[model samples]
Target chain A: NAGVTQTPKFRILKIGQSMTLQCAQDMNHNYMYWYRQDPGMGLKLIYYSVGAGITDKGEVPNGYNVSRSTTEDFPLRLELAAPSQTSVYFCASSGPGSNQPQHFGDGTRLSIL
Target chain B: TQLLEQSPQFLSIQEGENLTVYCNSSSVFSSLQWYRQEPGEGPVLLVTVVTGGEVKKLKRLTFQFGDARKDSSLHITAAQPGDTGLYLCAGGPGYSTLTFGKGTMLLVSP
Candidate 1:
């Protein structure tokens, strides 16, 4: 069912470079989230969207931006990549219910040098 | 901000051994969820506990929620290598956002 699909599974970028981590869900969910996980650390929220055309900054939003132009796509953008931004990024989606369990994408391994 | 603290950041046990991991927080949550992640993958949902003092079992794994809804535990009766993963605990504050603990990395060796 391709619950959640993320593009660019792996990428390497030079300092000051920019890139977009693409995420799409076909479940017709209303909620989507972007998170990054450092080695040996828990997932940190970067941004979230409750529905199309709506977005909100999460706990860790520095150096990143997000847009929700459609119900199926929520992309995360790194304006100027830095080494500190190197981590595994995950995208998740959930139904309208606040208590609904989240479905996650495989992840995008990003490295900035 | 709500925070969750997990103990024994890392654990390694032999197969068939018994072990328990804990997730505690000072903030009350409407519900708590447990997820397990393998190398190179996102965390996968294991279970969710809502009612305080509730107990739920998933085969050999048992999950319990504290009476105050601020703590939870995961117990493995007979561990196996397949059970090895990074276990994360998240608390929901009756909203769409969730606060996640650092996580307990488990390695069940054969």
Candidate 2:
């Protein structure tokens, strides 16, 4: 169904490099989120957007930025890659509701050396 | 900050075994969700419990929400190899955000 699609399923970056992770959803959900999952840890929110042109920082927003220029696309940017930033990135989207379940993409496995 | 604690961080059992994983929190939540994540994949929604003391069943899996809305449990009856995955619990505090537990890794061997 292509609910949420993430590009670059795997990527490797050198220290101090920069890159943008692409995420797009076809469900027309208003809520989009970016999360990083580390080994043996739970998913940590990096940023979120309630709708196009409206973005907010989540629990862990340092070293990252996000833009929601359109309802379907929300991209996360890393200005400078750090070793600590190496983790699997997940993009999720959910319809408007208090209890709507989030649909997630397969995820992008990122590594910084 | 609200935190969800999942017990039995790792579990290994043979086929036809029954096991239960737990998610506990001190803070009350408006809703709780269960997700299953396999290797190289993102978390997939398994179920969501909103009301207190609510119970939902999906085939061999049963989910329960505590009456106080601060805890939840997932019980699997006669688990199979295909059921092996990481089980995560997330609590919603009446917003779009969710506080997630570390998750329990389950491995079922046939």
By lDDT, the best candidate is 2
lDDT of 1: 0.93
Task: Write down the TM-score for model 1.
Answer: 0.98
Per-residue lDDT over B20-108 for candidate 1, one digit per residue giving the tens place of the 0 to 100 score = 99999999989999999999888889998999999999999999999999999999999999999999999887776988899999999
* Candidate 1: residue A44 lDDT (0-100): 95
Chain A structural similarity (TM-score) per candidate?
0.97, 0.97
Backbone clash tally (model 1): 0
lDDT for A84 in candidate 1 is 97
True contacts kept of each: 0.59, 0.63
**Could you give the TM-score of chain B for each candidate, in order?**
0.98, 0.99
Q: Candidate 2: deviation at residue B109, Å?
A: 0.5
Interface RMSD of 2: 1.4
Write down the TM-score of every candidate: 0.98, 0.98
